[model samples]
Every structure is written in structure tokens, then in C-alpha cells.
Target: MAPTSTAEPRPSTTAYRQARDTLVALTGQHDRAVAEFRWPEVGERFSWAIDWFDQIARGNATTALWIVEEDGSELKLSFDELATRSDQVAVWLSGLGVAKGDRVLLMLGNQVELWETMLGVFKLGAVIMPTTAALGPADLRDRVERGGARVVVANAADSAKFDEVPGDYLRVCVGEADGWHAYADAYAEQPHPFETVTASTDPLLLYFTSGTTSKPKLVEHTQVSYPVGHLSTMYWIGARPGDVHLAISSPGWAKHAWSCFFAPWIAEATIFVYNYTRFDAGRLLDQIRRAGVTTFCAPPTVWRMLIQADLSGGKGDLRELLAAGEPLNPEVITQVQHAWDLTIRDGYGQTETTLQIGNIAGEPLKPGSMGRPMPGVPVALLDPLTGELADEGEIVLDLSRHPVNLMTGYLGDEERQAEAMAGGYYHTGDVAQRDSDGYITYIGRTDDVFKASDYKVSPFELESVLIEHPAVAEAAVVPAPDPTRLAVPKAYIALAPGWEPDAETAKAILAHARGHLAPYLRVRRIEFFELPKTISGKIRRVELRDREQRAFDGGQSLSQEFRDDQFPDLKA
Candidate 1:
């Protein structure tokens, strides 16, 4: 069976046979799969959990989902066992007033309860609002009220987080709890598979957009966009059925669903995870080697940290490698390639979309460039001023072409949605420079771009160059206050292992930056500080920008080095 669509017919490489033939090719390794593939034109009443998983789970009583640990502990669930458990859970949840369209907030870690709740919610046709365990009381209040969540499924240990959140919503806690409803009791009920009472366009998931500058906006996705659009993601990862794919991402983020759920399941792959109280690169590599992980995906932060560890110090049968969440520094890419002999392929996407751009397997690799748009994706770079597309500008999707993977709209923000979808293009608010060779290198965010001395500066470009320096581990570039040039590029760096904060070290990094960057684009100021990151490991540049503004407002002393002021005898 192929992915089906009920909307206006559109033209693309995706058709009914695209998905079916791709599946057949992946399973059979036939050359004709590409030529015979089709993306099913699904009807308006589509439920992928019911359509795909149930059909595939029939008669497959063997292991379906596996959770392994570093201590040799593992939890394995059979296809039949999970199906029956989910059926009983759906009945029990529905009886507790969780009906179709009612939002259910889920806050858990990398445990089996997360998957069980996901299946039960999809079976009951309820909207899932995945929340990270890192969220505190205030964030929980926002999620409960503004998120329209009528029920919450969380771990018993974290149940106290909702104590300050005033609501009449139903509380279902996994594991032992004192005053909360015990979720394990649902198994006492009769097993019954659920019937879908809603269509494919129904609201199935609501994600809280990590508002870096403002309040978090609620992004809504229909039942189909994530379930079906992830086909592009599965293809990008080159994940095959039974492949043990491990993606280093936490819950509540879009990347989690991309590799952890929709994409892996669509490819019939086994989702692997290693619970860690602290991040140990060597330990993680050991788990991968011991588990025989086939497909591995992680963010740039993890990739950078991994390179600091000994590559040959560990052994793993890692076949496919992927990096996302943010633009990767070329130096990190070079180090990994030099050590592992495997290029860390770059990909581009946002919370609003799926794997729209990526460096797929069997495709050419480009340095510091995210590969061309994946299958079923149409990407165009438009000039911000002229509103006309060019080879390099802001990335936008031609919505008139009707990509099924597109989101429904931002909840309660019609004007924002209109602005986003204006002029028949959905602006991504991020800039990328595209080459004639079809490779796109990610620039800074639209707001992150600042002008210095009448010359536009991309923070990412300077930051990437800063990270190339031996003393720098992570860096973020921003414009600093300058009375003469109006503004100058400044860098906040996290030193590499065994590196220290000293005048000698800072001067060397600044000299290296001056050689790589243009005269006006050089890093005039440098500060040795830790990079602020979100729970998803993405650098919080907004925090750095705020600190820069504060320093500009008040005279403050920070470690900064400039050219022509000192240090004249360097290679540059």
C-alpha cells in the first residue's frame, strides 16, 4: 500500500507508487524500486497508525520495539503484546473522558511508557501534546491552558511539576504515585482495538514552538503530515526495516518524532536508545558498538562532542550518519570525516516542516552545504526585498504546489499564518546560499543577520570560522558596539578540551579568525564563555544576543582581542 492524498492533485516526483515501490526496493534491494515507486494518494479519512502499523503488525508476534541499556538491561515488546496493551489502554483512557479531539499532554523520558502512550492516544484518536521533562511549573501552566490539554500522561517522579498548574484535567501517571491515577491498572480491562472516528486532516499533535525571542507559538499538525511526510525523512536517513537506528534527541522536539517515531517506524526500523544521567561520549560509543547500531543520527552538538573523544577509542558498526538540529561547523565535519572516514551529512528543516532538505545516501556530499531538497519537497530561495526567488536567498516553499507535509496553521494566530503563507510562498525566516550545483549552505537566521560598517554580516559564517580555531570548542558570533565602525563582529567561544582562558590563547584565536574572515567581517572581540543551549542541544543565540546588548548598554570588561592593536607576528 502507498500513501494516499485527497487534496488537489499536484505534480511532483511523489505519486501512489512512490511509497510502495520504495518500500519494496528497500525490502528486496531491487533496482526497479525507484522507477516503480509511488506515494499513495490517500483519502481524507486516513489514520497511518491504523493503516500502516496494524496491517504490518498482524501475525508478527516477535519483537517490535526494543529498549536496551548500557548495563545490559533491555525491555522488549512483541507486536501482538503491544497491540493488545494499546487496545486495552484506549478503552480505559476513553472511559476516563479522553475522547477524540481532546488534547493529552505527554511528559516522559526515553522509556517504554512514551511509546505505549503514543499508541494508545493514536488509537483513541486523541490529540497528542508531547512535552519535555525539562519543563517546569510555569511552562506546564502554559501547556495546560493555552495548549487545550484535557489530560496529562507523565512519569510519577515528575508528577509534582503539575502541583502549581491549576486545572481540572485528568491526570494519568505511569509507575507508582501517591495521589495520582495509576496507569498500569488499565491492563485489567478487556482488549479491544479502537475505531477511527476522525479524518486525516484532524488535529493530532500540538507542539510548543521554543519561542527564542517571544512567547512560544503552538504549531498544529494533522494526523497525516507527520505520519506520511516522514517518508521523506526515512529515505533521507536510508533506514531499512530491522535497522537499529539511534537518534540522539530528547522528547518534545520535532527531531525526536522525525527519527524516533514516524521515520523509523515507516521504514520498519528498530528505534534504539541509551538512557544516560550524564553525557559520556566514550560510553555512548561503547553502547553503539555493543548493540551493533546500523543507522546513527544526532545533532551538531553531539557530533562536535564526539570528535573531542577518541574515534578509534571505540568500535561500532555504524553504517549511516546524519546531523541536524542546526547548521554544522565545517571543522567538525572535517574532523569526523578524518577520524571515522564517514562524512557527517547535513540536513535542513524546521519545526513547521519535515526533512525538506538533506544529504541523502547515494547523493553527492558538499562541504558546509545542506544537500538539495529531498523527495516530495519543493524548496526555493527568494529575495527578501524583491520577493522574487533566486539561486540564494531566504528559503521558502511554494505552497500553491500543495505539499501534503505542510502544517495546517499556527493556532490562534491567523495574521501570523497569513504573513507566513503570504505571496503563495511559506517563508522559512532563515537564509541559505544555494549553489548552481544544487547544494544549499545555511546562513544565519533572518533576525540574526546584522550590518557592520555598511557591510552585512552572517553570524554563522563567523562562528563557523571561530570553531575552526584549535582553542575554540563552540562559538557564537554577534555584532558588538563600536563608535567608529558603528558595529563590529564579536565572538563568544567555549574553549576546547585542555584549552584555557588566557591572553595568549585568545590572541591566537582572533588572529586565526582575521585570516579566515574578510577585513570588515573579522572578530574584533572574543569572550571565553560556555554556549547556552536548549534542551534539544541547539545553541540559544538569543541569550547571547541579549548579553551583548546588555554589555553595550553598560561599560563592562570582557576578554576581547583585535587586529592592529597587538600581536603582529602571526602566520596571517
Candidate 2:
């Protein structure tokens, strides 16, 4: 006889659906949306993976995940498919001794198993420690030790890296690997409904910040902080139900959760992905055209590369174009606008918080501005020296409101936590200037901004001008020490295709900077070198600053560097 089976009653999502529908209805109505929206008051025993994802996924046939591989292969998973699969994985993992509060280290690429594990872990109320696949043994060891991870999920190719990482954690490999549990075995298990064991404030994720200046800090987020807080990101990206949103970010980064998972999922939209081993802007555009991606988000690096390709191929039904990871230069935005007739909105946020400010849809965009403070996010610019509110200073969030988007301090670092949460505010450590209309224009980081001839010089401001030159592809500006002025603006440039690293190319870039910038902010020194970047592709300006300091101390000039003074005719 066949095994007897009974259907389980669908989980109630009355409150969750009410809140989600409110935001979905208010799309493109910025003022009304901000004024009427309120963070849902979920009581104890709230698990987004179960309460939200699975509830909405019931009998839903809409594609939730679409992954296109480099070799023209693809994988599509509907909401119901993922829901059932994750349920099976959750039961399988639970049998493997994984339980509530366990820390599971997830280090996988953009694969179906990554999503399944994320959902399964959440179903078990386990804490997720997301690490990039690009990490080596040293980074992995630090994550395991600092994060207190008890289980590790990685691809078969990365299993060998764990040999050097000493831990008693359960090793679960996505594909076949010796002595590791096969992820394929989970699919054979009987699917079961996931029971919720999480509270609203329970720890859900631990992220190691992409260390650009110092060592990476462990950023902790609760079940609500990210899953609920990304409502602002949904608003910023203009996500809507039935829309396809493609956010060009690698897994393990906060932005991935921001758009690739929570934001789009909350909006009941399709999460589209193009998994490429190597970035080909033309190929990416072709996929976008083919997929009918409605909303798109990418870092400045990817946007710059896209403009180099022929953008005329297919617009891909793209309605909203957004840029983050760093401030979007006006020149790049202009190039895209000229090609697509759509403005690329800029947004500002960090690993420490959700979307604090952004150029939302249905708003007039200032070319270089990052738009206004997101609704429900109270922002103030405090003078770095005075610690008083100012129009142009360090950006901070008012702690009085206790915004749900902010992280719950850095884990295991009370000193840093206190410093960041001091003065009744959460200091962002970045500087910006607000106009009378309240739009914020990003300056360099608080540490990146330097003084030259008693005038403050923003490297971003200078680098923006440098990239406007035809010969330059990417540029990093740092203050080079000088005896007379203490420090001067020096540009390290990576040339565009067909441009050489010769003196002529440097001269042309310097001339362009001199023409576009003020006399005090001119690019005095030029060097043709590759900019150092973090594994997540963020430019590490701190590394370049250290190099500048060392060069100044040695009093020996690098042979590769070119100075504006070296070419007399190029100077203003």
C-alpha cells in the first residue's frame, strides 16, 4: 500500500502580507510611501524564511530565482520549488545534528544550493556567517575563529582550502568531495514543513565587512534588521511585484542580501542573476535584453565597464538603473544616460546599515548627488571636529529613533561599538554635503579627504575629473606629500583600452584634470598603475595612501610616476 499523506495547513501571514502590500502599493509615490510606511511589529517567533518566503511561495508559480551560466546553461527555480527543496534540506540538515543557534559558515558562489542552505539554516533558526568564495585559508580561518562557526557549507572546489583551516565544524560540500557530506543527498529526503524557532531580534546573519581600511569586522544582523530593513532598498530600487530585478553583486556581500534576496523577494519579484566567470559587458547586456530584467543595480566598476561595451544592443526592458558600492561619477552616469535615456540613480549605504539615502524613482536627480535620506531613516551631518550638526560633515544616523536598518554593533568589539554609537548617533565614518534641498553629495571618506595648500581636497572629486579623460579607465587620487604644501593631489590611473602607460597618456590625463578642476584641486602628480582592490572589487584607497606615506618617508620617487611639472606644457 502507498504511504498515507496529509496536507498541512498554510502558515498565516496576515500581518506580513499587510505590510508587504502597503509598500508594494506605494511604489513611485515617495512622499506618501515614506509618510505612511511603518516597520511591521512582528512579535516573538518570527522567521522570515518561513513566515515570509514560504508563506508567499505557497502554490506560487512565479520564478523566484534565475541563474544563467557563462557557457549558456541556465537554472530556474520557482518560488514553490525553492520552498519545498529548502524544507527537505532543512530536515536533512537537522538530522545531521544542526540545530537552533548553531553558526553555519556559508561560502559558496551563485548556485542553487547557496539559496537552499540559506533558507534551510534560517528554518532551523541557525546563525549564518556568509564568507566570499574568493577568500583563502587565512581569511577562512579568521572567519571560523571569530564567528564561532560550527558548520561549513562550500563548493567541492573549495573543500581543499578547509584542510588548512582547523575546525571541528561539520563539512557539507555542494558536490562530491572525499569525507564530506554530499548536498545531493538532501534532495532524496521527504519534504517537511519547517517549524519556526526564531524571535524578531534573534541573530540571523554575521558578515565580515570587506576590509578596505583596516581588518574586517564582524557585523551582526538580527532576523528583522536585514529581512525587514531592506524595505527601504526595495523603495530605492523601485521593485514591484512581477518585475525582474538583477543586482550585479557577488554572494556573501550585504548588497547581495539587499537586492538579490530580501528586497526583491519582499516585493514578490523575480531575482535574476548572470553568473559569469569573467565579466563581459556585451554578454551581460545580451542576457539583460533576453531576460527582460526590469530593474537593475550594479557597482560603479561594473557600470564603467558596461559603458565601454556597445550599450545599444538591447535595453532589456530596464526601467530603473542604480549604482552603489561607491559614489557614481557624473561622467559615467552621463554616458549611460546618453545611451539608454534613463538616469542611473546613486545610493549610499554600508555594511553597518541598510539604505540610508538614495535617488528613488519618480524624483528629479542631481547629477552628482546621492539623493535624500531614505524615509524612516533620520540623518544628520555632524562636524568631525566639533561633533555638532552641520551642513557638510560626517554623515550619521539619529539613534533616538532606533532605526531597524542599522546593525547591532560590531560583534566582540565593545570599544569600536561605543565609538560608533557615541553622541546619540551612529556615525557612518563617511563625509557628505547636503544642499538646501536636502540632497546629499558624497565627498571622500572621512579618512580619504586630505588638505592641500590649506584647502580640503576630495579624492573622489579629483578622480571624477580624471575618469572624464578618454585615456583613463579608472583612477585613484591620494595626497602625495610635498615639502612646500605638506601634501598635493596625485592621481593613480589605469588607462582605457588602446591607451599606453607612457608619458603621453599620463600627460593627456593630467591636462584633462587641470582643465576640469580648480587650481588648488589640480592633479599635480600622475602614475599609471593598477589600483588595489578588495576581493569584493572595492578600491582600497587606504593601500594607496599608505604607499604615498612610504614614498614620502623614503624621499625617493617611483620611476613609473609622472608629474605635471615634468611636462611644463601640460600645466595650467
Every model's TM-score:
0.92, 0.97
For candidate 1, lDDT tens digit of each residue in 1-572? 22222323322213422583465355323223334434466666756656666655545554667787657799877656666777778888988988989999999888877887888888888999999999999989998999988999999889998888999999999987767788998889897756566697898889887776567778899887888777777877888766788999899877888898888777666778888878899988988888788889988878888988889854367878889888988899888777777777788887888888888676667788888776567788999988888986899999976776778888988888998899998888999889877788888789888989999999988888888877888888877777788888888888898887877887889889878888888787777778787655667778887887787788764535343356667555
Could you report the Cα RMSD, in angstroms, for every candidate shown?
Answer: 4.3, 3.4
Name the lDDT of candidate 2: 0.88
List runs of model 1 lying over 4 Å from the truth.
1-20, 23-38, 313-315, 555-571
- Candidate 2 lDDT over residue span 127-227, tens digit each: 99888898999999999999999999999999999999998899999998998999999999999877788988899999999989989989999988898
CA lDDT of each prediction against the hidden true structure: 0.78, 0.88
Lowest summed lDDT across 10 adjacent residues in model 1 is found at 4-13
- Checking candidate 2 for backbone clashes, the offending pairs are none
Q: Name the best candidate (by TM-score).
A: 2
